[model samples]
Target chain A: MSRLAAVTGIGQTQYKSARKDVSMAGLVHEAAERAIQDAGIGWDDIDAVIIGKAPDMFEGVLMPELYLADALGACGKPMMRVHTAGSVGGSTAVVAASHVTSGSFDRILTVTFEKQSESNAMWALSIPRPFSMHLNAGAGGHFAPHIREYIRRSGAPAHAGPMVAVKDRKNALKNPLAHLQIPDISLEMVMESPMLWDPVRFLESCPSSDGACALVISNEKLASEGPNKPAWIRGMAMRSETMTCKGRDEVNPLAGSDCAKDVYAQAGIKDPRREVDMAEVYVPFSWYEPMWLENLGFADEGQGWKLTESGETEIGGSIPFNCSGGVLSSNPIGASGMIRFAEAARQVRGTAGEHQVDGAKMAIGHAYGASAQFFAMWAVSSEKP
Target chain B: MRDVAIVNYRQTVPVRDSGPVNELQMLEQVIQGVINDTGVALEDFDFVCSGSCDYLAGAAFAFVEGVEAVGPFPPIKESHVEMDGAWALYEAILKIRTGEADSALVYGFGKSSPGYLRSVMSLQLDPYYLTPLWLDSISAAALQAAQCLNSGTLTEADMAAVVARSRANAKSIAASQLKGDYSVAELLAEPTMVSPLRKHDCAPISDGASAMIVASPEKAKEWCSQPVMVRGIDHRIESSMPTLRDLTRSESTSIAGKAAGIAGVDVQFAELHAPFSHQEILLQRALELDDKVDLNPSGGALAANVMMAAGLDRIGHAASMIQAGRYTCGVAHATSGACLQQNLVAVLEAAQ
Candidate 1:
């Protein structure tokens, strides 16, 4: 209906449990600068800045974008701050894309970061609120019951958790900026790891990371004048619902399905299993790989496990997913969604070194937050929409 | 090119009392007033975005109730900004430009009556460097006022002039709080709230909300008799590090002004969000408006500084002037953080 916008550049930081080396501002700047460089442009070339993050509490700063303006080279330019729970990164990218597609700005710098190590995520998310019982159990703990339900419904074996943990840790080896690197990791190590949430072992869960993700989004005009081939944003969609609602299916969120449907319709994608080349779905917990696979309509209801069980989610498998280690190997919370989007772009560009999906022309990037009710996803491709 | 316009505008009056009603009640009425004024159903708006601070509500996701206020059954497509609703307007505009939605609803709310407004604003400063010093917001504005005075840009008399103009301007505005004419000499005689900034020099603490609905050119005509088209909209930011930025002038405002085509704007009236008297002069200079412009026609934030929503309210007032056939063209401004680190400037006009 309007001029298409595309991702012309992408960059990310080496996610880690603790980035003792750099401050939060410095961590974000590193990613932004690299993204600018990748786009073969300077800060002056950008028209606006749109930054997103999980929460202000994650870094103990209130609307940190105010302070980060100068650091982000946003001085005297329209800058915006977005927050939509954990899916903020994906939402942030879409906001930037809107500016481009709307013909408001020719070039925009979109970034998201979370230095979760600055404070404990479990404590940060569990900050007591009025009229609400403090469950104190982290998001994984909140989802553990749902995960159990999925396990019972699918009748998948318990060891399937370790299978994904080992596969993704191995995928992390390909991403130079990945946070966790268990070079000697094994399925045994994953199986033996302490079960923090039953069926969700400590090691099986994503590591808290201090990192950032950034992208330089531009419209067809800028893309046509780009230094590299553009990742055309075929379609983007975000749908959010109450975290506590009657008939809220934590196991299979309707929002996630609806969001996927909206984006697929725009992208003109009919059969994701056949039309889409690869995927980068948010998987903070290992089981989400299968859960989202089903929710996204890549498989029949409850048959997501079969796709993963048959190795279809691996790098070379049909409809390969999470080729950049996914969120299981790195969880920066705010930046995690953008990382998934960036990894999906990498595969399409044929730039993914260690985990390249051959001839990847189209792919999907997805993220969800807050009891899995909030969902943000995008369909991207090397070919222009 | 497609044009976007503000089809409707509404705000809750800022005063010293809200009695016993909670956020839910306040939002319910404000949202109803706005939706009815716009003549649009909740589902008619293809996009919805808002702005508010969680800390001000003394809880997390305080704006979540605001979404409920919209009665978003079937899940209306929406997003949020942690900044002022003025910025939310900017995001909503982006949606229009992208062709994702033909219309949008942008709103914001804040309640500062429960806490010390100045003391709570210190949270917006740098946690490591500024927070430990406990530099509240009003004092910071006062410091900038003192700097303006020292720079010989204006005197206490000039500061009093701004206060007099703002208060006098509010007299014609409906439900305006601080409206009346007083001489600059009289204002100087008033007691000071903070050094260099008298009680009259600073805006009153207010708790309220504002909502605006915007539509595409085709949809705009269907909704309103006269929609104030968005001619130009821009925002800019300076470093939050107070020590690194110039306190006397808003560098961010000047940048935003230029991007918003301020040079070409033939102004009639403006609704400026000047929390303090001196900052108004600073913003005017940054915007480079000569004697041709009628600035702050509604008394501005100086009359009732309601934090997040006040900025958007300034915008609403300016557009109302144009929509009511009172102004041929106009401008509105909104600011955030200490020392006016972030600034938004919007230009409104009657379509040719």
Candidate 2:
């Protein structure tokens, strides 16, 4: 008995290594103001605000929504802060959608941001623990071994990783807000980059960035009377598990598969490869593209690399991926997932100026975090459900 | 919102300093205790949501380890919030209202004794404008108390009376960290911890965890002996800047109270999350609770404040009163941010 919800406005701040020009409040306000303006409404129109971000250590500000309440126009309104590691951005949108679907609120503002320059994410992430050893490694170091394992099991060609890097960095040229823009990116240049983590080259890993993403969600009534073409939300889901339980599959997590299955069922999608026009998936490391493709049921186990190697994942291909350059090019950590979700909505609305996939009727957005144990996904369509 | 009820709730004794016990171990005790109290197996829950601050642990993604305590081997659907656990309950309630989940397990944990809590709380302020000045939590509350005192809205005796009553009521509750019987004059005579505020006027820095199981109406009837129904719940936040807000009043609490239908109805008892004694007065006035209502029956947070978990503890204590046949209906309030910048109000009732 859930009501219908739609995405009427999407806004994002320019991705950068350090947003030194503005404070944390200013950075989020930059995006939130744009979202409210794009929704063809004033700050008074929003009934609630839901914010998501990585750990509080990212900005040394605990429960940032408290400090950001006025900046995002959430004063005297129900404001929520979500944290699910990296997948929080996507989960935040799902939570916001639930408010509208449950007949709780009409228009809601959902925002996510991470100011990595405030403090060292690596130090915050790898602090010494009471019962555990000091890993002293960032996400790249932790994820590299999984990439090695994926290569060992799938026997995918070495070129698979480089190809993804070249495609996404080249795609960044079309996105003005993307952090990394390599107009002539090629496979050789990516392969020649220094090896930071064993299987993850320097160019294959995502950079530490400071940015924010904001979206305006509305119930059916307001969406129908909106000025812009709304991207109707068909379904959304979130799932999680222990980070490293016994007999856990890190490369292809069951939580991710379950999340995808639940969302597809709610969207009435039987065949994702044929039904989903394009996808914007979280891929901080280049190798994650194929790994997630298989885990998300787009390709069979041990065969997802073939999709990337055959040029089928590029724009105008059978099923395009990362058409807006995705997380590899512009990753603000906390906002990375929502950026993917926002890009999918932009595609369905035919508003993605340079990166829009032609005739994109439906699209999928996906994000994973916490050693691949937490996941969130959503589906949006041009036509109302 | 759909009809949801709190079937069971459990919490650890708030300790001034929880030695050697990590958050996971403390959470395991309550997670298992609440499930056992409700007679609901782990698999019976359709979703799990938790609240905790990583800054309290001084590590990033510290909550990720807590999922292990929930036994997420089968990969349960779940989410987490950075606010108090009361907000986690709000999300679970919405999930049931959406017909997406039937029942949920909500929990919150924090260990604030490891750090200088007064300074650690400063991190909740605006980073560029307020945090850099190192305005400790006590100083901020003192500012609000000064305003309330200057306006004659509150008196030193009123604040001491709150402390004396909290200490007396907390003695019967085993989970309370500080419990004693003292006169208002005796408390007022103590040396000031922060000018305009005495040591008894502030909550102790406690460490503990709390867990609650909420279910839809049908499920609640099948699972529990006495189910406490959640009538209406609403939460609102005010401007963060102290300069932009009226420090003497809680505008967010007043708004949330009305939205949760706290008007007209006879609210028999209350559990208010007031870490500072003066805040208790502001909340009482804001929610319009008169002398007839039994306030802070379990000592509220003044006896034991466990940071993130104390707010949810207030909700559970209020429902417990109704379930125990002491009151027919009650109001519970949880506040976050400095000087009660954010507030949540829930009205709980038991079937007559």
Candidate 3:
């Protein structure tokens, strides 16, 4: 049997367009130090370090973990770097938990970050390759067609996208570390925003930010001994498929659904909407909120937009989603997924300060990447399984 | 720990430049080869993992395209690492040990021929300090080699001997890129590319891919008649700053070798991934392998270094040697970063 693992501590840097105050190593070290402190442990307590980032081109550093090893206190310890496109953050956490669950290490310091300000993410992602079309501008252009398809299929109102944008930006008010904290954000404001891609406005898109997220994962024994409440990892799963396969569902990817099903099975949840108290799903575009809702089995197919229109995904709603502002508000690209995972852990730990979902016992974190072909999700709970 | 063994391994022949052939095509050949040789369907594996660097490919999410070769139409449990394929194998081991998967398929591919590999590797250095200085990989190794030579730890003759042995060994390996009989004296006579390091001292920039399937004991028995058991595996990293680390020795290798239980096993041979010739001598001492142990029978990385895939190739060669009844037990070592800042070691043994 696999050993139990839990998140004992979490840390996150303030998301911003640029962090001129710190270097790359300093940026990662800040999060790691805070996580180590949050766990009430010293550098010596960590058994290994696992880090993840989107691409080396983003920071112009190939395998930055090799250089940041000293900053993260990974010297003389096993260090691993994980990269699975945009889902890298969540995958890094899953890999770190494996270290504990595999009965290999006791305490692992896992971190994910993105310094998009260091390089233009759009340019880095849109590099022209041989024999490949260059028409798709950036993520916005690549995903805009999928959003249009979702609208065309679901017959959801055009207001559905604006509603999600407003709710998440408003939710950002409660998150001090959120990058874009427009205190007066509203649906009207989002609707009036300039259309960067047809059917997707500037306000509905995620920001390019510099930030890092860290988590201190420990085996069951060490978890119980930690100073803070542990968010027990009930289950975790990752799934991937080819980016462009004939007859693939881009709007509601099977990988996301399968990943959700696998995680829920491990967590022993028959009904996710009733069992999961809250979720922090990856929604770089506001429309993805509803798309992922159905993919995660929280809503019926073609009816996920109805949940947004009904305000059921708000902070006080039955199944609160993105209560920590989510990727829409504070996207550090690579760290966005881990932020979702860490936010879920924070809610279960009752440490989400202002955005805490009251009495949240079980929560799930989700992230997808690479044309929605990669999916990673994990279920966490205050109660141990 | 659960018993796991490498059931099958396949790799493309290393080439200086695989012109017109992309990474996906190279990977497909090896992945298909492994499947055909083992008679195992793709869906039979419980997990799939890969290792590659976007920097080497000069595009973001390059590994994503490599995934197409796997034809994951039904979606599959998969993950990836930015490290060497040896680390991918490490993750696969963890997955099996965690009881999450009974078997896994791991692969690594890199097309280093597309770019100026020497300068491209500088991007892996500290961006603020080292990269700005443009300290390419060969110069970095030369710095380490200079330190080794200055310390009298090993003479230039020792490095030449390693190059000679590697070249002679590559003659029998079909995938090897550099192969020809050459005496140590002839190699030493060649002009140095970088001071204290001859042109032959460096591993060539080769493009290639490798794939391997590992399974639990029960599955191993059902699949292969002589599965090479993976007795122990461990990897560790040291300080990344070249100045902070001892350039003359591979401390990380020593630590990982000890952790992998290398000392307890009567290792009959060893496959060491030493990109620089002098590194081979340093690693031999660090691993404490005497002359009795056969070293780099597949020419190691000196003959054909495929960047991310070379490390995994070492493990594959080690396991293959045991499977061929060439040796009952062996150790495989892989290194990464400058001056061997990180290292992985594994012990493979044939069924007793």
Candidate 4:
């Protein structure tokens, strides 16, 4: 194929339950401007703009890209809108990178945003079609049973869930843009919080937020001229499988494993645990940090919760994951996965402000969607692959 | 850019209420027919991409089951878009451009019969300002049509003529649900289903699927001697608010077509997925394809608009004409979201 692509700029918004100050288009523009600033160029330098978000139903704006183009300085450029469920953010980034990799565009701007406050996701997701069953349970209900299965399979301590919630929230305090910041959060606070779904307490669930993420991907020569040093895009891969069947492994999903394997292979790493310095995973619920940890092959199956209990996922740990608070602390649904990816690049670039893990060389970014059946992951490094 | 050309194209007979075959079955039959017509094995293709929506199937990731159509024993490099197959075709070409694959197979299918197609479609609008009100797709389009009529952007006579011409064209095609020749006065005699948009003015909820094969320039020469060359292609979107955009014309289509080299073509035929007759006029104005272009020779979406796939079929229909040696150059158009929120235009030519 082509040589490779690198990420020269990354930006994320101050995620919140409702960004009432800015409109949906405004939220995305804010992030795009930040990324442009970070890249040390005006919007005129951008060759093409690629955008994505979850379903059009989420924000009540069908193909919001149409409304967002001018705001993001994409008036005369070819802007491609992509929709691929939750991993849309990562998919959008890949599509932008593909244009660069295909020798079409030299520098591409990719952005994904979700203004969840614009509509009720619980109700929007439950728009009863003609023949489908109506369960207004939303995301928590859709994924809780799977958490129960992970608990049963792992046979981990009950405190593992609370432990993860406290740690990730505390990490959020270090991240100014993270959506949630619980002042007095602790293991006890998490344990005492009202359970929204069994095993998923109120403190554990991600807040529906209004936020956006943006990235500027460029060729090697172009990346060298960025405002801050760019993180070389080592590898990117995406995988999918049927959402349901006779035997679906929610805890150790095949799609997650397959996606990880492909991404790791592309990055030329046989042992992800040893080769990767850190990771930023899509964890809307606290428990998924461990579940996806195992699913991502960072640890053996059923032992991922042990990584959480051991405090290994926090900063300074051997494999520090979600140093930028992750989706658990700031989830704007469609933009969450891409935020993970941009955060990973930040860590590698040594530009992660307060949340930067020390001297991190290579980092992994992961995102999953649709009952954990779709997975997209990539590796970024201080050194080019 | 990768030199991807349309090598094979096929579609099922559009039916108002097709029986027995589910979405997957329809996809398989049409995709298999495409492969058979091409004289190529299904596994010979290096990549497969599909386009479809979950809302139409009453579930999520509706295109997953379509893998059975290709019989994926080899674990193909595949992807699906929650859009029309034309976009999927665009992505597949990108893959080929990146040197990731050679030839690719693409398809899209939807059965709107199971659901309140129009109501489900309303979910595509901005949920906060519009969907909470539960505005069905027909009423929304009807409102736009009424607004168009009131402003003298389109007349009732003009709308009727579009219906009459489409039905007249549909009679010659075997795979059409609504077909008949009628005068403008006869259509005006019918009662209104939605004000300003009679039943004849809107397209039926068609149950159909379509498939197309694309190969790089080298592979296309090996597969088909007379490949329909995709000369230029591009898509664009306008604003989301209905009032903000001009309902009478599609600025987005005009921008995309001009960007895609549509203005450079000596257009011989065209297929614009209007759905509503009035939309045809708007699309025509946007593409600037006047009397010189023979639009919707395949009866167009006015006869059968199968949501996501219908738009892709527009591109395929135009390209098929080029392959049949009927046109030197042609234009195809596909629209998405409400009132043509997004538009894709492809310029195709038959190389001499």
Alpha-carbon RMSD, candidate 1: 2.2
Query: Using Cα atoms with residue i matched to residue i, what is each candidate's TM-score against the true structure?
Result: 0.95, 0.99, 0.99, 0.87
Where is the poorest 10-residue window by lDDT in model 3 chain B?
A: B57-66
Model 2 CA lDDT for position B316: 90
Q: Candidate 1 or 4, higher DockQ? A: 1
DockQ of every candidate? 0.58, 0.85, 0.85, 0.32
User: Which has the better TM-score: candidate 2, or candidate 4?
Assistant: 2
Stretches of candidate 2 exceeding 4 Å from the true structure:
none
Whole-model lDDT, model 2: 0.91
Clashing pairs in 3: none
What's the best-to-worst order under lDDT?
3, 2, 1, 4
Candidate 3 Cα outliers beyond 4 Å, as residue runs: A133-135
Q: Judged by lDDT, which candidate is best?
A: 3
lDDT of each: 0.84, 0.91, 0.93, 0.82
Query: For each prediction, how big is the interface RMSD?
Result: 1.8, 1.0, 0.9, 3.7
Model 1 C-alpha lDDT versus the unseen true structure = 0.84
The candidates, ranked best first by TM-score, are 3, 2, 1, 4
Residue pairs in collision within model 2? none
lDDT string, candidate 3, B1-352, tens digits: 7878999999999999999998999999999999999998999999999999998888888888888989997999999999999999999999998999999999999999889999998988989989999999999999999999999999999999999999999998999999999998898889999898899999998999999999998888888898999999989899878999888989889999999999899999999999999999989999999999999999999999998999999999999989999999999999999888899999999976
The predicted structure with the larger lDDT, 1 or 3, is 3
- Name the TM-score of candidate 3: 0.99
lDDT (C-alpha) at residue A117 in model 2: 92
